[model samples]
Target: MGKLYVVGIGPGSIENMTIRAMGAIKNSQIIIGYTKYIDIIKSLIENKKVFSTGMRGELDRCRQALQLSRNNVVSIVSTGDSGIYGMAGLILELKKDEQVEVIPGITASSAAGSVVGAPLMHDNCNISLSDLMTPYELIKKRVELAASGDFVISFYNPKSHGRPYYLKECMGIVKKYRGGSTPVAVVKNALREGQEFQIFTMDSFEEDKVDMMSIVIVGNSNSYLKEGRFITPRGYKLMD
Candidate 1:
């Protein structure tokens, strides 16, 4: 049986992809991913059989990739770290007797933090606002805890068609424990060709301004604006 490589391409830019992912893609006979993401690196994989899917075809995509892997080396690419709500989950779920390897990438959460400044260096937690399969109550609980603990929060799937209200609800939860003046960055399409970075305070974030393509980062209670930048220190330690 052939092997599969679950690669994280990092946000929406080829530059963010790791050398290892590049190598894997080059060696793979089949490549699969969400259409828009695959389009970004289409030129790089001209020799491979490409499979693209839409938002709701995740299961179909995984199954097809697995079947392809049974005969040839296949690589399914995700936007961020495969462990953080990425395609690795679906691939593993579809796996029966096949082997797979996961290649990590710079997650949107981390890339967003870096683009906006250094707010992630301190306490931070990554959360997904999408409630397609998961319960909203759990997501709300996480926001509450992250807010109370003053942990910088990187939120994925902030909004979608019927789920636009999810982001608004999250804002309310965070505001309950944290101040409204807290820093928030709506890093959209981070590091991509058309990347748009919007800076706002927690109170200033209008839910309508955000969508599924964006990642919302809510700064911690201790997060401060310094040198015209948003910063969060991870708490210095003495090596001695």
Candidate 2:
């Protein structure tokens, strides 16, 4: 039996990918991932047999990857940390008898944070606004609590054509706790060639401006904007 490796490719940037992730892909005879994610690493997967699927095909993709792993070394890839919102858990649940390993990569939250500024330097939490698998009620509750606690928030899968209203609802919950002037950053295609970073305030934030590829970083009560960078300071006394 061959081994299965679940790898995270990071924010769709080769430079952001971990060495172990690349090694896994290079060693595998087959590579599987979401259609767009596979396209992101197309150069690295040159000669390998790649299988891709569109949205909502997670289960099918996992099964296919495992089936191939039974006879050939396989690497299932995900953009950002696989364990974060990737295929690692689904693969493990159906592994049956295959030897499996999970390789971590730079998650979009951190990647987007790095590109915009230091918004995550203080206490933070990552929340996905996509309600495909998770219920919106639970997501709303979590967002409410996170905002009430004044934690810097990283929002993933913030919006899509089908679920456009979810982000608006989430932002409403956030605005209830955080002041309208709270700092926020919208990072689109983080770490990729066509990256776009926009800094705005909670009141001025527009839900229509974001999409599935965007990662939204909202600052805590103590966060601020300075010199075009959104900064969330870690509470620490400085030595004079």
Candidate 3:
């Protein structure tokens, strides 16, 4: 049996990707991933066999990768860290006895956090607003718990045409625990071309500015905005 490597490509930028992730892809005989992620690493996968599928074909891609790995070294790529809402879990669940290696890379939360400032300096949790796989009620409860616990919350798949209202509803739950002035950062295409971010208060956040490509970070109660940066204090006293 051959090796199966699950790689995280890190925010669609080669510069953001970890060296191990690049090495895994370079050493693999076959590459499998979503279409968008494949395009991001097109330059690196030249002369290699690549299998890409569009949105919602995750099962097929993982199965194909597993089958191919039985004969050749296969690398399945995820946009961000493979374990974070990525293919690593699915691959591990399906593997019978294959040698699998998960190569971690920078996740969207980290990428967005770096772009906006230090919003994730303290305790934080990543919550996906997309309810296609997870129940909507559970998603809301997670949001509420995170907010009440004063953990910085990073929302993935915040909005799409089909689930436009989910983000607003979750934000409402968060508002009940967090103050209206809590800092929030909406970062789009983090670390990639056309990257942009906007910082706003919880009450002033514009849902229209977010979509599937964006990662929204809502700061904890202690978080604040300084100049243009969003920050969450880590409780280290500083001299004035």
Candidate 4:
């Protein structure tokens, strides 16, 4: 047993990754992650073994990483925070067969939020736009509940090649309860070298502007923008 750091590299950029994530990567003898994610850090794994793949092979990826960790220092990377729709859950599912450490990383939503200040200041829920593992109706219901409850929301797995309409669909669901002018924050390439942050009203965000690499934040009733950043107050008042 060598060390296995299930590190979260954060959304696709080297700059966005923390020193801790870098330290693990630098010390590792092996690196594993999705193919696109691996491409970002290709130079970092010069003399190390690298394993990369896309969807459907996620479980196999985890298994291979786990087995390798038994013999070497292995670092499995997730794009954003590993726990949020990352490799954490999948790794944990194999808990019965293996035990590994899950090193936290800044998730896309957190990075996205930071760009526009704090969109999750008060309370909120995180949801995904992808329907591969879930039903669209259920996702719709979740969006509806989040909208009705006024939860500041951070969305993950927003859109991909054939799923360009998911975000708009979610927006439509939210529009039913929230106004078109409601504030929405979109962060692309968060923390990465070429990061782009956009703050706009939900109804005005162009569908062409989002991609699988992007993260979308839907504001609550109290969420507002200050100096181009979206913020949601924690709602704490002083007793003075």
- The reply for model 4, stretches above 4 Å from the true place, is 237-240
lDDT of 2 at 136: 87
Per TM-score, what order, best first?
Answer: 3, 2, 1, 4
Clashes of each: 0, 0, 0, 2
State the lDDT of candidate 3 residue by residue for 1-240, as single tens digits.
Answer: 699999999998999999999999999999999998999999999999999999899999999999999999999999889999999999999999788999999999999999989999999999998888999989988898898998999999999898889999999888988888899999999999989999999889999999889999999999998988999999999999
Root-mean-square deviation of each candidate, in angstroms?
2.4, 1.4, 0.9, 2.4
What is the lDDT of every predicted structure here?
Answer: 0.84, 0.91, 0.93, 0.82
Best first by lDDT, ranked = 3, 2, 1, 4
Best by TM-score: 3
**Per-model TM-score on C-alpha atoms:** 0.92, 0.95, 0.98, 0.89
lDDT of 2 by residue, 1-240 (tens): 788999999989899999999999999999999899999889989988999999889999999988888899999999899999889988988888888999999999999999988999998999998887888899999999999998999999998878878888888888888888789899999999889989999989977789888999999998998898888989788789
Q: List pairs with backbone clashes in candidate 4.
A: 10-79, 81-107
lDDT winner between 1 and 2, please give it.
2
Candidate number of the best lDDT: 3
Q: What lDDT is reached at residue 173 by model 3?
A: 88
- Candidate 3, poorest ten consecutive residues by summed lDDT: 172-181
Of the pair 2 and 4, which is ahead by lDDT? Answer: 2
